[model samples]
Target chain A: MPPKPQNLKNPIIWFFASLIVLWAAPLFLPTFYVYLITEILIVSLFAVSTNVLLGFTGLLSFGQVAFFGSSAYAVSLLIKGTSLPFAASFFISVGMSALAALIIGLFCMRLRGFYFAILTLAFSQIFFVVVYKWTSLTGGDDGIVGIPKKPFLFFNINGPDAYYHFVLLVVMVSLALLYLIIRSPLGEVLQAIRDNSERTEFLGLQVRNYRLASFVIAGTFGGVAGALFAPFQGIVTPELLHWSHSAEPLMISLLGGMYFFFGPIAGAVIFVFIKEWITGFTEYWMFWYGLLLMLLIMYLPGGIMGFVSEHLKRGKDDSR
Target chain B: MEFSYFIYQLIIGLSYSMLLFLIASGLTIIFGLLNIPNFAHGALYMLGAYFTYFFLHSLPGVSFGIALVLAVVSVGLIGAFLEYVPLRKIYERSHALQLLMTFSFILILDDATKYFAGTDFLSIAIPKLMDGSITLPGDREMPVYSIFIIACGLVVAYLLWLGLYKTRLGKLVQAGTANKEMLSALGINVPRLFTLVFILGSVLAGLGGGLAGPLKAVSVGMGETVIITIFAIVIVGGVGSLKGAFIASILVGELNTFGVVFFPSFAMAFTYILVIVVLLTKPEGLFRTK
Candidate 1:
């Protein structure tokens, strides 16, 4: 008999299996669900980026959408005006976002807690207003529409299956890289800083450098998600840069449980599905959504993943 | 170039500052005492504006003074209800959860306003008695209503200061904030005090919104429109300090007035820049402890 298959309980094996499923999902699902899956993937990447600062570094940023929106516009502009391929445009978009994050992070990382959140929010709002007023380049309020998603180098990546596979590959690779970082010596130091910054400083670790590094990493991933999203949606709008939009991934991170590594992915799935389902029913979906969030906070402050973890631990205790 | 225009802008800015102070003082109080950042403070303001709009429009022969009083009291009741039900439980939860709940209230309140008031902008007509213009020494004429707003703000501030310093309830609240465990140990009903504070804060916010209705465009998203600026003011003023809120509101309002005149291009960005610079220099705020 063949050796027993790898245990599904292991997170690494589970993650790879989930990636395979994500890759194969479009072949069996309806077109609408496929679109939903794509949204989930994009938002998951965004949420993961948010979690890097929020969960890992204990920094709550309220302007993560700045990078996301900026990258979207950058990619859209490049694709619209230049002869660069999709891959090159994406690279350029992420690079531009990283540069922006570096500059903003210099000013922002100095402050912590509410001040940091507010500063980031102010920066994003400034970006939003500028984009809204800069009609010449950004198309202002009407936004840049009809962005073309070219076929990937030598692969017909226009169809849902192809795009889904491409996104799956990209997301898996990114996650793998993130996991490596988490398991690295730098990741250990970052965790230490999160638990006790004063102690970490006394230990001679550069707390600010670690924070800025995590911020840049988060920003680069946010830009990558934004670059993917522009082509997927075929539009890049000022709304993407709005503070309200920035709140989405933050909300997702909270709802999914920031403590877990894959918490944002779970959150992305729940958020997109809940939004899609609720909006289908009534225009007052926001009211109910808000009520649900209130309820969740009151009763389940640990979020969905945290709730699951508690139950799993209880189950193990009972079996023992 | 015009002297009267400068004075007019100054008064208008001060009036705007009064409204901001009324709302932001309550916000700062709630944040300081409860250690909960109430994002729904804006919703209470919106409710106040909506209530004033309906009261003034629907009721014939009712004075603006009476309508304003009714609007403040009613919005205060709604705020009390929110605190008693949803916010009361999450008092001990993480800041993230508190933020989420408040944020959810924003969505709920926005949609509720949309459902009731429709999506269009609603304007309140100023009372005929106060609608007339006052001629300034520099030959610049400004609305008499603005002067009334400034007077109202002063009256409210005086009352709040008196209540906080002189009243028995004020002593309890001060004691509670300083040492909640001790207050509870001494048999003070801490929860009741919190409820009272929440109501007072809510009413002030509502009053601010109601008074501002005539000046600003009152619409579905109007609460969110002013909230960011208010947050900036609160941060700059020092969170939880009433005096700080007052001073910060004036500072931000003056910045807005002058920012528009001197730097039209950067008018909107000025408040945020001020906040950033102040925060960098003094991260806790200009007046409060970290």
Candidate 2:
């Protein structure tokens, strides 16, 4: 009998396999490694959510931080101020993001390309300014501090290890949901719009409505990540709302392979490690990082996953 | 507010508007031709201020005018290098890539500046020629530098208008902005024109920075603080319209000034609100050029 090829190409199997490994990872790893992985997972979720718009829908937004930051702030405030359950606070924060996205998307969807990017940026800056100047409500630049990691649905997820497990499970479920979303018909329609909105509109689909849907979807998931981030960090700041901070996920998406579903995960791993490694040695890390980004944009626009997939295809072609 | 105070604030707002116009005009012109949003334009403006300060301090007995000229020229050279190098490779790429590429320049330039300039807020002195304030009828005082800035803005606007509309090169620029392929097909050197336009834009940004040094804090983060406001002006005016940038700059500058006085808490939000309002009403901008 001929040798059977490996089934590594199947993402579900890979997903479950990675989940098993990651779920067991904290058992062998130190508390620091566990915390680091938690951070990476949060960033990966954020990047993947952003990719839904940039990669799947072909929209380059500069205001995604608004959703993420607002949710972070909301979750933090609710945890600190009210007696609501963690789950309720989480849901409310994400819901607020969705509502915010809908309203902003309504205005922004009318514009395209550069105009869209600028309008979204303008809106996000409004959020930033509000967060920065609303000292009584937001604590202004000092940000909200000392946020407790309260119990969630009878689970004591307060310590670093417990929180890591909670984050891992939540991120995995979110990733799975996002994966299913991208694999569904809505995802196909979004991609179709990305490739050619005029053709999609010719098919009788309302392009603007679809874009708004994508925008809200991105914002909702971004809110989830933000909600996760607040408890993980034990604090939240207005810096989260800044437009410059919005670039992190976009850079991660681009670095990971915006086209691939698992690309940002790969990117998040590399990005976190690289940032850690670089910042360890030099304060001039931004200069080096900028240089890397420039080179990537210039020569490696397809990113790491794109490069890997292309080489794999070439190998298959050569064997054929 | 008292009438004299209102006039005083109005003049101050006009000076700020002129400075903003100088920066936005360059950005609009560069965008008009090169079709790339130069995120590093603000960085260049920062460099202009830094270089002017360096020139003034390093070269003893050097007048501020001499320092300003030298600083602008240096900025123009850097702009040329930027255009000839990384920016040149991305003309055929997507706007996302172009934006990222330009954004990288900001990171590089800002960090490089911090490495050399040491993260301090450096200030430049107003030239002796325009250092004092004039008293108005109601005992309100306005800085002479404010009047100088307003004059500089009007002169530059007039000169830019003349160059853009009255000169042959300006006509070529306008033609190129309208249709690059046609201009290139006509045997005009489009690449050279692009380089020239980019340099011109950079010089304007540099001049704005140098001129603003005496009025505002010159620091590493100054580029970032101004870039968003500059972008709002450009978009509000119309991406490629000089007149649009001018009008939008004035509107934003005055709104910010008055907002600060009447509604301090809402001041920061005013420019963004104006942007949202304009984009919602007229997606292309108020004075959209072709």
Candidate achieving the largest TM-score: 2
The Cα local distance difference test for each model comes to: 0.83, 0.90
DockQ score of each predicted structure, in the order shown:
0.65, 0.79
In model 2, how large is the Cα lDDT of residue B129?
95
TM-score of chain A of 2: 0.96
Per-candidate count of clashing residue pairs (backbone under 3 Å): 0, 0
Query: Tens-digit lDDT track for model 1 on B201-264?
Result: 9999999998988877788787876778888878887877677788999999888987889878
The list of candidate 1 runs beyond 4 A from truth reads A1-12, B58-61, B137-139, B175-182
**lDDT of each residue in A1-320, candidate 1, tens digit only:** 11111222576887778887877787789988988898899899999888888777778888899999999999999999899888888899999999999989988988877778888888878888788878899999899999987876777678776787777777777777776676578777777777789999999888999999988988889988898899888888899998878878887877887766677889999888888888888777778777777777778776788888789879999999
Q: Could you give me the TM-score of model 1 versus the true structure? A: 0.93
iRMS, all models: 1.4, 0.9
lDDT of 2 at B204: 99
Best by lDDT: 2
